[model samples]
Target: MKLSVWTYEGPPHVGALRVATAMKGLHYVLHAPQGDTYADLLFTMIERRNHRPPVTYTTFQARDLGSDTANLFKTACQNAYERFQPQAMIVGASCTAELIQDDPGGMAETMGLPIPVIPLDLPSYQRKENFGADETFFQITRALARPMDKTPQITCNLIGPTALGFRHRDDITEITALLSDLGISVNVCAPYGATPQDLTRLGAAHFNVLMYPETGEAACRWMERELNLPFTKTVPIGVGATHDFVKEVATLTGVEPTLDTARLRLPWYSASVDSTYLTGKRVFLFGDGTHVATAARIARDEMGFEVAGLGCYNREMARPIRALAREYGVEALITDDYLDVEQRIETLAPELILGTQMERHIGKRLGIPCAVISAPVHVQDFPARYSPQMGIEGANVIFDTWVHPLVMGLEEHLLHMFREDFEFHDDAGASHHGHKAKPRPDPEARQPVTADEHPGTVVWLDDAERELKKVPFFVRGKARRNTESFAAEKGLSQIGIDTLYEAKAHYAR
Candidate 1:
C-alpha cells in the first residue's frame, strides 16, 4: 500500500464500523490487530459519539499470529454476541487480519449465532472507506430484507445516510420535511437510524430516494432487481436539483407535487443585482463523488460561478465526475493524493475552493478561501447550527458558504477607490478577522511590460493602464494576460486605449 502522512479514507473495515455505529441494534465483530482499534477514536473524538462504536475487535498480536488466530476470532464473536446481544451482527477482518488468510465470516457462521450475521469480504488493498461502507450496507440489506408481496404505497425509503457524513443529520431533517410537505411518507431510512427489521419493510415504499450514490446506489439497484421497486438517484443539494428531485418523485409516484417557491431563497439571491459580482467567480472543487458533483451543479446553475476544476478521490464513481468535468470543458482530477489536489489548486488559482478539510488546509497555506463541502471533514464543519447541504435550506447554505469568501461588489469597488489611503492600504490584511493578507506582486517583477519597462516589448499606454486598474485586483492578472494575448494575436506591438476597448469587445463577442 502507498504510504503518506494523511489519507482521505481509512481502511475498509473502518467503513463497516461507520455503518454499524450509525444504525441501532447492530454490532460489528472485527478480526483485527490491536492497532486497528484506533478507529474507535474517530467516532469518539472526531464525531463526538457518546458511545464507542458497537465494534468488538479480536486485537490479535504478533505472538497470536503463530497460533490459531481463527479460534481467537470465533471466541471474540461468541463473547460479542453474548455481551451485546444485538439484533444483527456484521463479521469482518481488517487489513492485517486479511493477510492471515483466516476466514472470520466462515468461523462466525460455524458458531450458529441466533442473529443474522452478515459477512463482509472487503479487500482493504483494493477499496476504500466509501466503497466499503456501500458494500456493507448492501450486504446487510440483502441478508435481512424479507420477501414482501405488499402493494406499493405513497412512500419511499431514504437510503445511504450514515454517521460522520457532511451535514447528513440536518439534510435528513430537511428532506423529510420536504417529502412531508409533498404528502409522501418515509417508509424507512437505512444505515442511519433503521434497525434490522426495517430492511423487511423496504418493499412497502412506492420508490426509493438515494441521498448519496456512493452508499445507496448498489442497494437500490438490488431492490429494483429483486423486488421491482423503482428508485430515484437524484441528490437534492441545490434549488435546481431539489426542484428536479421533487419532479422525479412526483413522476414516480404519479402525484403532481406543487412546490412552495417562497420557501427557497436561492432563486432571488442569485438574480439580485447585489449578487451580480458572484457571476463568473472562479471555483475549484475536490471531494467525494456525491458532494463534488452536487457542488459543481450548485456553483454553475444556482450561483453562476465558473468551475475551474472538479474531481474526487473515489475512483469507483469517477465516470460521473469525468462526465461532469467534460461538460465544464475541464479535465477531472481523479487521485487519492492530497498533493495532487494541492497542485491543481495552485495551477487553477481559483478565487474559492469547495472541498474537504485537507483542501481547507491547502487553501489556507496558499492564501485562498475554501469551504468544506464533503467528508473527511473537520469538527468545525459539524457545526452546532442546523446547516444542511440538501433541500430548500441547503440552497441558502450553499449561497452563503460559497460566497462568503468573495469580496462584495460595493466593498471591492470602495477598496479599489481608497487603496492608497493609509487606513485602506494595500498591505492591510483581508477584511475578515482571521483571513491572511495576500501579498501584492511588485510592479517591476510583473511579466507584462509598460512602455517605460521594455521599449521593444508590447506596451500599455497611460489610458490603457488606467482602464486596466479598474479591473478587480483578484482577477487583474487574468485580465492583463488575456488583453496581452489579444494584442499579440491582432499583430499589435503596442497596447493603447483603443486597442484595449477593441480587445474587450472581441472577447465579449
Candidate 2:
C-alpha cells in the first residue's frame, strides 16, 4: 500500500505468478494494466528461464477503464486456457487494478472454462506477496487433493518452494536425496515441479515436509487439519539442524536415523582454524524468518561466532523471530522499511552481514563485508553452479559462500595497511600483478562516521581519531563506542591514542 523504491516482496499478483510459473501445468490470468506485466522479467531474467512465465495479463489500458474491464478479463482468461490448455488456472487482480473492482474470481467462474479455474480472492491492499502465494497454493490443493490411500512405502510431500526462490531448485534436489538415504521416498514436491495431477495424490503421502513456510505452511496446516497427515517442522539448513531434521523424520516414519555426514567440512574447518582470528567474531543477519533463525543457530553453534544482531522483514513471522532474538539477547526487527534496516545495521556495526541484496549495497556503502544468504537477491546470487542451501553439500557451499568474504576482507585490510611498506610493496607488485599498480585513495579517507561521531559526552582528540581509523571498518564502530565508554567511566572528557589502546586492553580482560 505504501510506495518505496525497493521492496522485499512484490504485490500479491506477482506471488501468484511465482506459483503459476513454478508448476508445469498451471496458468495465471491477472487482471491488470500493461504496467503491471513487468513481473515476468523477474523469473525470465533473474531466474534465467528459457521461456517466459506462464502468465496472461488483461493489460487493460486507461481507455479500457471507460469501456468494460470485466469483459477484458473474461476474454484474456478464455484465451489463456485455450492457448496453454493448463490442467488448472488461477485468476486474480493486481494491486493497482484492484481499485477498479473488477472481481476477477467471480468473473472467471461465470466463464466456466473446460479446466478448473480457481478464483483467488487475494486482498491486495491488506496483504503482500507471500500471503498471495500461500492463499493461491492452498486453494489449488483444496480443490484438487482428494482423500486417497497412502503410498505403500513411506512417502511425504515436499511443501513450499516456488519459482524465483533462493536456491529452491537445488534445495529440493538436495533434500530429496537426503530423505532417500533414510529409506524414504518423496511422493510429490508442490508449487515447484508439481502439477495439478500431483495435488490429487497429496493425500496418498504418509506426511509432508514443509520446506519454506512463507509459501507452503498454509497448505500444510490445512492438510494436517483435514487429511490427518503429519508434517516436519525442522528445516535442515546447517549441520546441527540437518541432524535434528533426520531425527525428526525418524521419529515420524519409524525409520532409524543414521545420516552419513562424512562430506560435511564446516565443523572441522571451523574448529581447526579456531585460533586464526575467526572465533567470537560478531555477525549481523537480516532476511526471511526461516533463514535468519537458521543462520543464527549456525553462527552460534556450528561456527565460533557471536550473533551481534538478528531479525527478519516478514511481520507475519515476527513472533518466533522475536522469541529467538530474546534467546540471543537482541531485539527483533519486523518491518519492510529498508531505511530502518539500514539504520539498525549502522547502529549494530557487526563485522559481517548476512542478508539480502539490499543489505549487500548497504554493506558496500558502509565499507563492511557482507554475504547474500536469502531472497530479494540479485542475478549474481543465482550462480550457474549447483550451489544449494540444504543437506551435506549445501553445508559446504554455505561454508565457502560465507567464509570467502571475511577471509578476503582481512587480506584486503592487511594490504591496505601495509600499502606504503618498501619490502612488501616491492615484492607484492612484481609477483601479484607483474607490475606496480596505480595507488588508490586511502580507505580511511572514505571511512563512514561511526556511532560515536554524533555530539556526545566524550570527544576524540585528533590523534585518537586517526588511530581509530586504522582499525578495520567493520569493527571500527564498536571500537569507537568502547573507547568512548571507557572515557566516560574514567571521567575523561577528551581521548588520545594512549586512551584508545588502554581502553582496548581494559576490554580485552
**TM-score for each model:** 0.84, 0.91
Candidate 1 per-residue C-alpha lDDT over 1-509 given as tens digits, one digit per residue, 9 for 90 to 100:
56898789988887788889889999999999988888667877887778888999999999998899999999999999999899999999999899998998888888999989999999999899998899999999889876576544488889999888888889889999899889898989888989888887888777889998887788989998987788897899888889899999998887887577676776676668877888888899999988999899888877888999999999987999999999999999999999999999887888889999999999877767788899999778778899998888888888788787775434665777676676565666454533566645434233566556666578877678877877765556656777888998988888898888888888778
For candidate 1, the lDDT comes to 0.85
lDDT digits (tens) for residues 1-509 of candidate 2: 36798999877777788898999898889998988889768987899888889999999999888999999999999899889899999898898889999899899999878888898988887788888888889999999988789989999999999988999999999999999999899999998999998899999999999999999999999999888789999999998999999999999999999788888877677667543577788899999999999999988887778999988887778999999999999888888888998999888778889999989998988777898899888888888899999889888898888888898888877865665587345335534444555444454553444436755556677788778867876677678888989998998877889999999999889
Instruction: List per-prediction Cα lDDT, in the order shown.
Output: 0.85, 0.87
Best candidate, lDDT = 2
Poorest stretch of ten by lDDT in candidate 1: 439-448
